[model samples]
Target: MLSITNEGGSDMKRSFLPLFAAGLSLAVLLSGCGASSGNASQATASAAAYQEMPAATETAVDYSAGFYDAAAPAAENYDMDYGSDAAAGETAAPSGEGAAQQAADTQRKIIRHANMTLETKAFDEALREIESLVTGSGGYIESQSIDGQSLSYRGDYYERSASIMARIPAEKLDEVASQVGTLCNVVSRSESMDDISDTYFDAQARLETLNIQEERLLAILEKAESLEDVITLESALSDVRYEIESITASLRRMDSQVTYSYLNMDLREVLEYQKISDQPPAFSTRLSNAFAEGIDSIVVSLENTLLICASAGPVLVVWLVILGLLVCAILLIVRRVQRRAEQRRAARNASVQNARADQPPAVNIPPKEPEDKVK
Candidate 1:
């Protein structure tokens, strides 16, 4: 009976294994189908979003064409205006010509710049006048640079210079520049105008389009259901916002420059005021001028050298004293050396004389030989 029970139990286990295997396979197939459906839905959502963008962009671009036409009414209003003109029996400018003229005039953006080089006999007076002029003209000094005075060997008058960059109202630029020319000798003057009408209007139109795109993107983002869709919309929205900010900043900068023109002033201090001429001088005249310049340079250099020497008076004295002490020491050493040489020579001569005095045999031997010959 125990053996029969074991066989039945084994048979039951074998049957259960097949059933368990079939159930696992069915679960895998169902899970795979669910995953595939999810992926397909995600793809559909992404495709819908991406496909909608090109149309939106096209609509924005189309609207940008007439964005700056506020100066004139729409085409439908033109017929009404024409009928009113006909009933009133009054002549009106053609719609196309009038609108084009008005729009171009109102939309022109000009950036003006003027550069002037000025020389003045009085540096302080000129600089103060310029500052006062800039303020009185409803303008401000954007930048200024003035050379500093010398700390050592300070002089009553030195060669000084100044550079000023002024921002004046567009209408006041010419007036201010002319007034400044009257204050000092104008060495050079130049003016430039940049027309940024097309650039400005184009950017503005593009900005309007971007604004529309931003609104559309925001609307789409609100309805986004999937995480991938949300992420994609956020990234695109972020990009659009960045471009909008950049364009807005650029427009503001352009507006500021157009409203306020730039005037550059260079001022110099001089002893003599000289007139500037556009035509070159004669060869002989240039030679004389060069010679005078050379002489003036030499005089200036000598004056600077004198000033430097005067400023360092104490240091110069100390150096001279040191040099004199060195020369005296060298002379003393040479005198001592000569004295020692003379003393040595005198000692040698005395020793030779003493040896000669000690030698008496030569004379005695000569006398003895004579006596022996006589014997």
Candidate 2:
């Protein structure tokens, strides 16, 4: 029996040993794989962080030489022309150089704006004429507003006022202004010009620079071997793309402003009535005008009163309602307080009367008689 048992134990041991060995080997292999994966992940993360940084420095180093060479000529020419013009004091250039410089100067970007105020007796006619002129000249009205006030005795004809802002082509700005002047008496006219050539060109140059950087970054992204590098490059590319879009939008706006001229026009109807002179007239004239002036004054006063009431009626009603509510609330509180005080006073008086009535009356005569008898 002991021998048989020993043999069975040996068999079991042999099987267990093999199983343990296999498990150990599997664990070791797994550990090795985990270590390698961890190392790879770390490397990827480091690479990603490095790539995510701005490429300005690297881009400058890599492309500065070629970009500068390509972009310097225009700048140099512009500077030379500007310097020559400044020194020449607006005088004509001596040769072809002057003509070229003049041409360049004329090509500069400018944003023009004009403000005009006009008054006319025929308000509606003038308004229609102005609109027609603007449309005919390839211009569109950006915004317009009209206001009118009722004339006191003028029977349905309101004194009208209008303000209009229009955008006309830069080439036709002067022509449009002259045509508008003919529509009415030009009460006041003013114009201004802004030169933004330098700013516009600067923005364009910056846009080009960013575009070049974007292309280089894309190429680098393609060659990147690590996930980290790709993420970093993608972030940088997005930022570059955003800047490119913003610059493009700004350039478009500048171009629009430069191509189109802005005009602000204010139109007012001339008053039909003439003012009476302060100087005294002859006696006959004064006597005749007295009754007419008095009636006119009374009518004017009534019109002014009506205007004030129309403007302030709602506001005054709201204030009066609020004041009445406040007054009612205050009166209610006072009444409540007075009622409480009266109740307290009545209770105190009743308490005092009860105490007096509950007290015994003194018998003074009986006590004196007893005292006398005792003495």
Candidate 3:
């Protein structure tokens, strides 16, 4: 029985050893397969990421190309509108020259400015007429100012003035100015014109150039591969776009300004004082007028003097107080100095007298007087 048990135990141990070895081999194979699978997946992912970059670049390039193609005709149209000689010659029909001439005539961009000063007997009526003129000419007032003063001297005198800055249509600028001239007596008249056709065309050409540059930059941006390239191209594209917007705004402003003409109108009321008869006045009447004029001059002088005094009263009082205080201070100082000097002199004199009194007095020579009397 003992021998049988030992043999069975040995067989059991050998079977367990084989089973352990098989399990270990299977575990190793599974680990190897998993590592290989993970490596394959990683390689595929890296390849896909690289492939996406080219695909995105190609798409961006295609989009930019399409945009450029679309904008090409617009640029051509701009050139044609701006009167490119080549475009004009190519599209010239039977009346092409005439059409071009008309376009050239109509495309002249001019800025007109005018200034006029008018004097009128009636202020309100003239102002109304001028305003009506502006409105009738399809114009608007940019700014307006009215000043008036009524002085009651010997009689009531009215002085009124108005200034208006208006914008009128360029086509009707001359007509409007002429109409305004008829409203009142023109004191001064001025008109000026500036041609901006060359400048406008230059700006248009610059805009086209910038637009083309922008399109090119956009195309380059789409094809950019590295992060650094993308950032650089994007910055350039932003600058170009900003410039394009600025130029567009400037051109629009210029166009508006050129379309409207500026008019500066100045209106003044002329006041005529009551005059004596055209015949020579009587001597008595002349004398009375001279006397009245003298009285008026005296009254005006007195009023001006009163005004000056009123305006300067406080300042004068302040100055007077300051001067009084300074003079008092100087007087007090001088008095004190004089008193001190007098006291010092007195003290010196007293000291000398006391010294003299302290000294013995010399006896008078009475014998000499008697001798002279005997002689």
Cα miss at 137, model 2 (Å)? 1.3
RMSD (CA, Å), candidate 3 to true, equals 24.0
* Per-model CA lDDT versus the true structure: 0.63, 0.62, 0.61
TM-score of 1: 0.60
Clashes per prediction?
A: 0, 1, 0
Worst 10 residues of 1 by lDDT: 71-80
Instruction: Give lDDT: candidate 2, residue 97.
Output: 30
lDDT of 1 by residue, 317-364 (tens): 999999999999999999999999999999999999999999976654
Candidate 3 global TM-score = 0.48
Query: RMSD in Å for candidate 1, one decimal?
Result: 18.2
For every candidate structure, what is the RMSD over all alpha carbons to the true structure, in angstroms?
Answer: 18.2, 22.9, 24.0
TM-score of each: 0.60, 0.48, 0.48
The lDDT, on a scale of 0 to 1, for candidate 1 is: 0.63
Per-residue lDDT tens digits of candidate 2, residues 216-251?
556555544446556666776777688778867776
